[model samples]
Target chain A: MRHIRITAVVIKELIQLKRDPRSLVMIAMIPLIVMLLFGVGYGGGTGKISIAVVNLDKGSLSWTVLDSIMKTPSVYVKAYANSIEEGRELVKDGTVSATVVIPEGFTEELMKGASTQVLVIVDESITTISSTIRNAMLAVTYKFQQELVRSVGGSSVELIYSSVYGPKVTNLEAFTPLVIGIVLQLVPTSLISIAICKEKERGTFEQLIMSPISRYDIIFGKLLAFFIATIADMLITLMVAVWIFDVSVRGPLIDAMVVSTLFLLGSLGLGMLISVLSRNQLQANQAAIFIFIPALLFSGALMPIDMLSPSARILANLTPMYYFVSAFRDIMIKGFGLWQITWEVFALSVYMVLMMVTAPLVLRLRVD
Target chain B: MEYAIEISGLTKKFGDFVAVDNLDLRVRVGEIFGFLGPNGAGKTTTIRMMCGLMRQSKGTIRIYGYSIPEERSELIKITGYMAQRFSLYEDLSVYENMEFFGKLYGLNGEGLHKRIRELLEFLDLEDVKDRLAGRLSGGMKQRLALGVALIHRPKLLVLDEPTAGVDPPIRRAFWEYLRGLNKEGTTILVTTHYMDEAENCDRIGLMNKGRLIAEGTPKELKRRIFGGDLVEVVLQGRIQGDVIKGFLNVGDLKYKDGETVLRLVLKDASKELPSLLKRLDSMGLKVQSAEPINVTLEEVFIELVTKSEARVRGEAY
Candidate 1:
């Protein structure tokens, strides 16, 4: 491929992108907006979970437990129902996520050094909120048990959990790499595919095909342009993630950028393949979104791939984003070097090569 | 004897439908050749085959002695094709569009800049060089497309409906530019449905139903269609059809607007017209005007297409 021809295509595409301010703004701002939404809104666990409390005990110990649950940052006590029935109604009507009922136990049981259980009724329809409620209750009970043991002059044994990497990582920090993967996959893929399909729709594709430029030049030139755009988006998003959200990249920035560039190549290649397969911009947009959703879901971004079924795990291996998310986490969160994550890097490279090589072959020069 | 574009037995088929069939054509160097046909006449298909944009089903095409589909790269360097639509990047500035195409043709450095500047001035787009192509008027867009096609100074230019929707004055200006280019030894092969525009070509090939029905100069085609020139005579009073028929090879006679008009076919109108006038004077008929009416390209095209359709139907039966 001639460099001049490729340069021409690149320059022309850049000019077009500059003229369309709306798309340019979308490319630059979407990552920041999505990151802010995820980081601030859903970060460090969803805040203000609502639950109902029923205090049937006449003693003050039950009030102490209720106050402890209410003081927790993530839990919100909606009301103190007079009866267990009213608490259950609150949970059933979705007024609250769960109902914490203290049984009619006399304070004498705890005073005599006997253990009593708290009946926690919960709605199981919304799994995420229910799980959060369960964790909150366990935390409050654990604290109360420690205090009870200490007040009686008895030593308590505690189980402590630690992690090899990011021991104190927040939910936002853990989600940074996945957010990068999602942005790279969705934004650049759809943008490049739409750009290509728009050319075909507007009839400029015929002129390009008839020119002296080879097919590789056209595809590569376009891919390079969008790849640069993706890099800019990644930089802006990473800055926001690191400074604003307090997420750190423990590894070298160069390694992170390299892995990210490879991932971008893979995504851009997928976009080109979709562009070649689609007949118009609408079809291209649909195909890009279709691929993006599955990629995000199976990349272990939202959930661990190990939690997936065996067949789903195998399917996850086929997506470039899966390896990208894994490698991104390893490099950015775990501070692993390129040599340490060689297998993931190799997988991403292979995906990129396969997509880039096959895209042009599938591209039809004739409009019909 | 040198041909800029040569094709023999060129054929294209989409599944079972044949778009172009058993076509043979040769465009000479430095001459303007017009490809005339109605819609779906396979003109665009043949042009695309010549440009190597489509692979032919069966046959050979050589542009400037470069075999197409095999040496397409070499052919593309020497040939510039403007599609039927305004195919330039609409979002780019006019100068940017020209520069992009120029670079694709392997032009760069100061040379590319100079060529773009020259084209912008030549096409009267200098005033709007920085304006986006999508914002230009219809005539300006057509002119810019032509400018892009000529940026590389290719030896052969193939234009498909270069002025399809332009106003008349702009269309005439475009033809003038084409004529100027042809004078400077550039070969042009253009496809158009406009009959008046086709009359400007040095030679034209009329096509219908995927076949070339006729090929000649405008005058030659007119003579071939009617076997002579048509002479229209206006008389003050009605004349008997039989008396007008007494003249040899009188084509058609009709009364219109309170005057009797007579059409006659004469191989040599300059010699036969005077004799007919003398005969009319002796017959005591007052003549208002007498002149040889020029048969338009539209008339010739319609006649050729209708005759070909009838022949096909006759063969079918």
Candidate 2:
């Protein structure tokens, strides 16, 4: 409640934070490291589905089918096996995700107007990728049949693909907002979560509370110090996503900064609440991770909330991460300004207010 | 007399265990008051309640004229506390620690800086001003803790076992500083288990089993426990022990040296010994010598605690 007392606490905390090497490294380098990990994991374009092709038919039509399979953007023809056994060996040895075998009489059957099947052998261990490989193969065969019909003089209609942002939205660009939201959410929360508990464990809180300072002074002072220390990492996280990974941001940079500043405050508030409730540093650390994992999973950062069950959707709607990610995506992808994201702004404000108010209420001025 | 701290009916209960029970204590202004007890006598609990660090389950505490827990904010400004443990920020330098605490008490700018310098010099901590608190030796760390507690120049300084674990020389020197502060008109309430240290207190309160069993000056407590000062008297001739027992000022009498020497408990040995010698001379008994025997606080403490325990046992039956 007193400005002098709060300023004293803020100055003391800043000096302590500056002198602590471990915390300094966490604040300076964690965002960059997390962003790099996100870039490496998601920047490679959903990982091309690699498959091996075994051509048994000597006819020109089988070569055309093989070429069509190799030409599909999502599919990669990693190896040309001499026999079906070798192709199956490639899939079995994990060299490729799946194996496609063209039978010996594929062109003859198609010329006689009889339907014949192409055998596809796949390793099912890589569940998601193998399923995607199956779908890619099905599209390849369908396109080859259409080409045969068109060459025989049948009329055809074409389909075109376009994105709302542009005709070509790269994988990294589309995922930038999600990665930024995660970095802003997780790094700052984990960094500041142990602030109060560390004081309690070290016996310093006994001395701290002896001063004529209120709970509001302690909570807000720590909140302000950690915000100053962590805001650098937030900016670096955004810069890494935009400049290093070449992810485009369609809206003004100020809009992103404003949204990020609000989200960072909310994240710091959540960490402060955790710090207040916990008895020690280890408890606070575990609580931060326990709360963050669920937020990351159900917040529509990794997947859409629509794909989740009803209860999970409710959870997604409850977390601040969901709103931040949604708001960030709108600004980055759609060039939306701060005024346009009304729901997200209101939700984040509510989350921030709730955390800042509840932390001091639960904080005990007494050691016991 | 004006009291710096007045506590009545103070009780602290953790579930069914009562750490401090129905305690009443008053520390006068501008005097060193010592709270003495054995381990688990609830000395620290009582001090914590007085400092508003812990709320009493059933009692009222007024430090100076302000009520506790209601006017705790105002009370904190004029009261400084040093815990039993070294509770200052160990990572901070000595000067920084003092500055931080001073500012919290609303002393700032030129005034805060001046007070810090004054305390550093007064506590002989100026040389180690730049050293981290955790890196200081045992004596220096205790000194810094004391320095921070004095940063706001509080009217009342409350210390809970400030000299719990230190060398004899440092403890003695630490008390010397306390004596100096007491001279400056600061009301000090200190708790310690060391009987020898309690001898320095202007008044001592002996607590045992959550109760103040005895309270007085060290000399008064010794007299109270042993029924007054013990004195030895020697006569040139044999004396009648029963006759001496009937003396007006004698509390108890015993003969040694084949009835020639007598050990007598007097109500006031200094006042009565001279008169007794004169009276014996008038009765045709030549007095050899008379002197008051010395009693240590350690002996007084043991005697008082044992008697209280015996009384408690007797009551239980």
Candidate 3:
């Protein structure tokens, strides 16, 4: 292992990075794009949902409850026609994603110590947000119940609800980290894999083999460039997220970088491994895209992994992105420290070490 | 100098197919050695084996007293290999390509810069030091590739068809540079399909069907090829008698052309030519020209390979 071999590989890799403009842009744009997707797409904060209020309740109690719900930032009431059909149409036409129907005499039932039902109409297809609104209404009901008991000289009433897990948030800050992680996972791996394919396409790989540089040196050189590029993207994306989306990255900023870089190492190693096994550029791209598209889907970056089946959950954890997504969520949204995500960090580190360590053996230079 | 490369029973196989078989070659250091074969004749395989780029299935290769595969790094340290298609970082500048090789060879700082500057001028690529290699003409690119190979000042240069595509003038210029390198103590093992190019080698190894059938100096190969000399005689008029047969007994003789011309193969071509010439003159045939034209490597090579191929296939020549 001559010292020159490492330097030569590194310098050559840098030159290759400079030559490939597409990879350069992919690296620089991915993280920023993820952040923008996070900021604009996810981070605006999921409070103040629009609800068409079909107020058939001709009493003060229902009106007061509706007012309290609106004040809680849980739901904003838009007056619709008293007809139930119009309320259904509001939900159907998406003039409102949801609507609440208050029956007549709803407030008087309370005075008579009678139970009154509040008919709520909503689109079930918007499941996450529908559930979020459901939870907010329940909390408002709970508060109402507590206030009613106080008003009635401390006579507590039992309330029934089917769902658990309170809705504390609804917008982009919670998902920014996941988006960033997903973009981070995708860009470096795909770019580096494609770059390796380009070498095979151009026949520069033969020159690389004949040179004194070893396999490890070549792999390392490529990984370093990709890692750097991805990290740069990750930083730009994080900044945009912070400023534009208001998805403040919590915990140590450097730790965010550490997690992003390590995740990239795992992903790029997987890509390079694919590139090494692939005979041509098209195959390499297919393999990389296969990994990346599924990763973005199953990484639990958008929807909750909890919604998936047990086997799907297991498969989700099998991906390196799952750990990174978990790390980002915990750090950026949950505002957890390094110790809080020690397990996620450990999982990511293990994946990265395994992928990078075994990549060399997988990418054999078959001159025979 | 003693033989720089001594290979015996060298054979290379790809899984089941034998690419080079039982090849034996000996080339002296400081002498230009040529390996001649048609396309796919295992010329590249042999050169690659010598460079330690490939391992032989069976054989022993000793380059300047170092065993290969185990000592590939050692050989690669001092041996510059110019591949069939000379490779370079086409994106990098001419000087940058040289500096990269120099650094890889462990020359740095002023020494590296000085050597690069010298090679720049030597290859006549001075003004284009900053120009990308891909932008250069075919001849200039070849020169740049050569300069990169010479950056380490290798003792041996394994050039696989270094002059395959350059125009005749540039090829001539390239060979002159190569000869200059050989004079400065570089052992060059070169492969070319052109027989005229083979004539420049001090000794040549003629390969066919994965075997080296003949190996000797240009003169020795000629002598061995015919087991004698090649004499050419042309006359002003045609002749048909024992008078032509009385020309030479030293070797086989044949007359051709509209006039009676004969090529005589003999052991002592120089000593026999004048006697044969005088004999032709006395025979009352007006001689147009007479000379002892030695067999070209092409003749020697065709004789050896065709005979070998015929023998292997049991064909009558």
Query: What does candidate 2 score on TM?
Result: 0.94
Interface RMSD of 2: 1.5
Which regions of candidate 1 deviate over 4 angstroms?
A43-48, A58-76, A106-116, A139-158, B232-247, B252-263, B268-291
True contacts kept of each: 0.81, 0.65, 0.24
> How badly does each model clash, as a count of residue pairs?
0, 0, 8
lDDT of 3 by residue, A1-368 (tens): 36666676567667767876876777776666656655665454555678887788777788777777787666787656678898999888877867777788887898888898877787888787798789877877888878777886566766675642223544565566667777776777777776555665665555555556567877887777667656677677777776765556656777877887778788888888887777787888788888887687778876679989998888898877878988877776666777888888899989888888887887655344
Binned by DockQ into CAPRI classes (incorrect, acceptable, medium, high), candidate 1 is medium
Worst window of 10 by summed lDDT in candidate 3 chain A? A162-171
Q: Sort all candidates by DockQ, best to worst.
A: 2, 1, 3
The 10-residue segment of model 2 chain A with minimum total lDDT is A153-162
Q: What is the lDDT of residue B134 in candidate 2?
A: 84
- Lowest summed lDDT window (length 10), candidate 1 chain A: A38-47
Indicate whether candidate 1 or candidate 3 has the larger TM-score.
1
* lDDT, candidate 1, A172-201, per-residue tens: 877888888888888888888876688888
Q: Which CAPRI level is candidate 2? A: medium
Model 1 earns a TM-score of: 0.89
Error of 3 at B130 (Å): 0.7
* DockQ for all models: 0.62, 0.65, 0.28
Which one wins by DockQ: 2 or 3? 2
